[model samples]
Target: MPIDHFHKFLTSAQQEEITLEAAHARLTHFAGRPWLFFPEFSAYVTSFVNAMRNPVAVAPVDASLPLSQYFIKSSHNTYLTGNQFSSKSSIDAYILPLLAGCRSVEIDVLDYKNEPYVYHGYTFTSRIPFKLVLQVIRKYAFVTSDFPLTLSLETHCKAPQQIKMAQYMRDVLGELLVTESLDAEVMDLPSPEQLSRRILIKNKAAAAHDPNSTRPLPDAERHHSAQSSSDGTNSSMPEAKGGPSSSILSKKVKFVSDLAQLNVYHQGSRLPKLPRSSDSPDLGPFQPHFDQIFSLPENKLASYQNDFDRLVRITSTNIIRTFPKYTRVFSGNYNPLSFWAVGSQMVALNYQSFDFHTQMNQALFHPGNRAGYLLKPD
Candidate 1:
């Protein structure tokens, strides 16, 4: 059936309101927890939930909802864009709407001659200076919001200049900056916020550059590659397909410790830190914040179970891979089938607003156009 017809049936059946309530209840259970909204792709899930048979109620998007703030790139045209659509104007428009409720925003920091610059890689030249971007961010930061607009910057390379660029942002944005971990599961993922805080240095290899050296950060076993340069930096050289290091494991442990320290130092109180188990490596990274929030004394056992179950469901590999653009767009006899399955799905949904649809199309169709952000079109 056409999705539009399905939506109409949902509205006509009064099932729409019921499903929204169900979704809201699920969201409330997850309140105060960190959640990511890939603005471009989340609309699909929104539409799915809206069309589902469940009597869940989904709330309209509100900035102040209990969600721990997350960040995304400037690929979407936010309210700040002011209507005219050019690449630069597109980015200029999002600052305010994002600042409205976001606790943190991602900035991709590039190092140019030992200084940090804030433009995404796709817009300007590869070697654009960091100061130039900073000037623009300052000029366009016209957002008015109560909460401080925190920054979560990512460094594109292991280059020493990444560190220096981060320091510059701290100097400017001050305590609102949060240096995101580069070992963010995938390596060298684009982060714009790194321009505003210290870029997270993972292995000894990344540390060798000294863009802005800190207390010797611990080596996390999660090396991009084992091969090291004479300067102790991890080489971009690919590894020969073995597992990560024991020291790297310890480094991850230490990294968690640093995160705790940062929360305490910046956020005032330290969040709960769960003890690492001797049990299983299959359990992956443990988020102490989730543990703390769910463990609150008054929370219902049912609520905890519901949230945990949904969390597991959302984090599954299948759910993430469901994004059409994330999968390779194969070209063959089967290409027609793939296009219908993926491309048509993207075109079928009805968003709450036309602005949202426009922004999403930019992300779905032109992901490679953003600097600092990389989408594998392959």
Candidate 2:
């Protein structure tokens, strides 16, 4: 390489004048060029070569801290490869992110015949079989990092298919799926080291009235009626009515025991309303359960920020995930730093898009052993 080109790659401090003798000596020492042995230039070249080195040292990640205290690298719409509205959903989408050290991924599942399929529901995106997605996840989940992987499941499947979804996850993932807490008696959640090499399902738990049964609750019947009117038909598997980005709105959907049991640690729930007054005496009602996780939309983050103390209180004990807004059809990503600044653990980004925000996401997780989890600053 030419001296000028080599100088361009060095830091400013290393870009000082280089004598021909020093240059030849440095090249000979590092590259070992055969021509450097020529007698004509032997006298000018010296054995010693001064080289530049990185000044900053990377510290080892402390994985023993509570899981809620770290900012986890996460991906949104993990099955979409391109535009959100019309992209082809493939298992490779899951593989790419998992291998890139993404610890959390979203899986939107709906019923297809007797089986469950993964896709962006109510969109033109093609679908992949639920079982196949699980298999792919099992194969590549721990390739880059052994930290726990959280599967944020958005299930719109009926009873029978919901059972199959659970069965497939149990069968394919095997012991990797966390069926129960490692230390149930502990007050705080388990650490990443304790849950290493395991997968946690983040989904809504079944209603308490019939936790072990698939019977539809009263709310489910109301949702069925509303869904029938919206679709103008009595479809057994009613389509969820709303914008594509809206969450699984049907609280009435009955969850089978098999599927609900998989939500051992991270139970998905709606974000509760923040207290209007900062000096409000009671935060007990606003606080989320220890095992609960709130999936707040990007736009809603500002509202939470207004009550910064409450947000911190909620996040200190439980996990908070913030995803992209609904209108980002081009797969653009929002600045994740704002979410991270407010102590949100999982600031999920569209991994398929290499936008500025996504690049920042990559840079942030590149340190701390790239273990997909970094302890937040105090």
Candidate 3:
């Protein structure tokens, strides 16, 4: 390096060090931990702090790789601001996650007043007009991020209602709706680059029943759900559409094919119902109980060595979503690291909570770059 260039580099390094030190002071000042800082620390901490500001790339991330090979920030039950029972729901719920750079947000849709509503089904959780939620999504979808966003839809709508949802989604999302040719590769999910500023729906289209219909939300949980809905029309557990627990998968509604076509880029499932193939949709990192039931005792990721290895291998080539347990009625989240350790791409957290899980999520995605997708380890 030339002498002048070397001097300039030193000056730049010093400036960066000053900036980081000031940031440290500001953080501690707010935290009321000024005693934690000392003058001597600056000499040694500058190099380390500067390195942290520019972390080494964990994996090669560009336009070539498929979408499955990435860790994505995600949120579960995105609408409910409170507990499962008497909590409130709002369009702002959609805004919160999207603003925080969540690549995927879930919306529980049901037929209400001949139109679609978004909320927790069979529970007292509040309901917001689906169109209202769509508006929030449309406005905030690309503001914080230009990468693709997936809406995890759990539908309990009739045929006409489903069509209404389709039309409304198209209208609200407008040009952001990805109709076709989202991925460059034929056999894989598209890279984030391919679907920038696009929104993809994820659902088992035509499902008329709610999965937890038989198991009503307990009174406490129902109360929260009901409180979320201002009108309190569904204060009591609404009579389930289907009598038996034949499961939502079997309850076929109208517009199944139409809705499926709209979900071109992504699809969500609670289990590996479809065969293991490139065409198969992304199966869930199901809630603990659901995972235990579907994955089996020895096949569970943490309990079985082979299963953990299998998760890593599968996620390397396929997109997988792991969500928190449904029993967490308090809007709590799961330890995201465990899921990430198994190569889970979308460790869906309850963004409403400020728990350990949320902290981890912030740290992982804190690096500036509005791209919502994070490259998973190779």
Candidate 4:
């Protein structure tokens, strides 16, 4: 092969390292060989290769800032092995993404035989024992990254099962589960560095006044109802539509005090409309506090595109999470960049899909040692 052909494959920096004189010397040294195999030429080529001209330094992440300041690599409906409607749910679904550096995972819990089970509600998806899922998460949560793992829990179980769910987490996850705030007086959320290796519960907290009451909490019920209206599938209970599943779906349930109290940093709540201006003195009635997380569907988030500046202001101090639109029944993912561009902290995607959107997600989180958290660019 001509020397020029080999030189063309080299990057500019590589070419400078292997000068013309050096290449000629290398060729002359091999000229007398009886057999000039491709492997020898391949080895010569490989020696001059540089994976990147300017490689990023592999350093520990600066996780001292508030959790809202980082873009968390997240997954939606993480237990499904295939499409959203009827796919088989498996523990491997949780294993794959956690091993791949996903920092947040969604777990939809429903009551089965008076016990908590993990699966998609109002669908034909298979169920996995909730305890088994917790065990699997315990084993794999920090395998790829030790920053923090957020469990986006959607509970549809009564108080008894909700208590069991909390007990299972405590017994199986042990010290990995975060049961209280790192600081009692600090107003801001804890940093990823502070919560390293800890698991966060992102479920709606029951009313402080009555923890174990079966009565629906306004904030929790409103959030799930809005989500149901937007996504077509209720996170807690679906309205009676007259079907075999109607009796089950119509049963309203709330997370018990045991499970609700476990939510420390990421309290899931409905996001109120942003203030019209960044300098507006009055935040809306539903403005999320430091420890609260605003969960929005992709479609709803897109509606705020015209108010980009306000969105940025909101995300700067509060955690905003966006997931794929409910219409994506096949487990298709939305482009996460749209949400990330506006500083949304957790843009959850369907990990089962390997399409362009997911590819972009993998590439974005590939840096910072794949620690599953990246500081938002100012």
Best by lDDT: 4
Regions more than 4 Å wrong, model 3: 1-63, 183-185, 205-255, 273-305
lDDT of 4 at 354: 80
**116-155 per-residue lDDT for model 3 (tens digits):** 9987776777889999998978877875577889887767
Compared with the true structure, the alpha-carbon lDDT of candidate 1 equals: 0.28
Question: Quick one: how many clashes does candidate 4 have?
Answer: 0
TM-score of 2: 0.76
Worst 10 residues of 3 by lDDT: 289-298
Among all windows of 10 consecutive residues in model 2, the one with the lowest summed lDDT is 39-48
| Residue 270, model 2, lDDT | 56
Q: What is the lDDT, from 0 to 100, of the residue 126 in candidate 2?
A: 96
Off by over 4 Å in 4: 1-56, 207-251, 275-286
RMSD of each: 16.7, 11.1, 13.5, 10.8
**lDDT of candidates 1 onward, in order:** 0.28, 0.73, 0.59, 0.74
Error of 3 at 228 (Å): 35
- Cα error, candidate 3, residue 145 (Å): 1.2
Better of 2 and 3 by lDDT: 2
Lowest lDDT 10-residue stretch of candidate 1: 317-326
Best by TM-score: 2
1-378 per-residue lDDT for model 2 (tens digits): 455444433335456666655655655544344132222122112111231332235786788988899999999989998988899998878866775678999998987767899988778999999999999899878866889999988788888998899899999999999997788688688999999999999886454444564424334233433443455432222123236534444435677788887888776655645558768535543444577677877888777667777777777888999988878888899999888887899999997788899988877886424478998988
lDDT of 1 by residue, 1-378 (tens): 333433444467544543544444533332211222333123323332233454344332223311122221222112112211112323332333232222233344444455655433333323335544444344333222222332333334333564455455556544444444334353222223332322222111222233333433223212212223333433222111112221322121111222222221111111122234444323233322210111111112223332333333222211011111201112001111232221111111111124454344333423211121212121
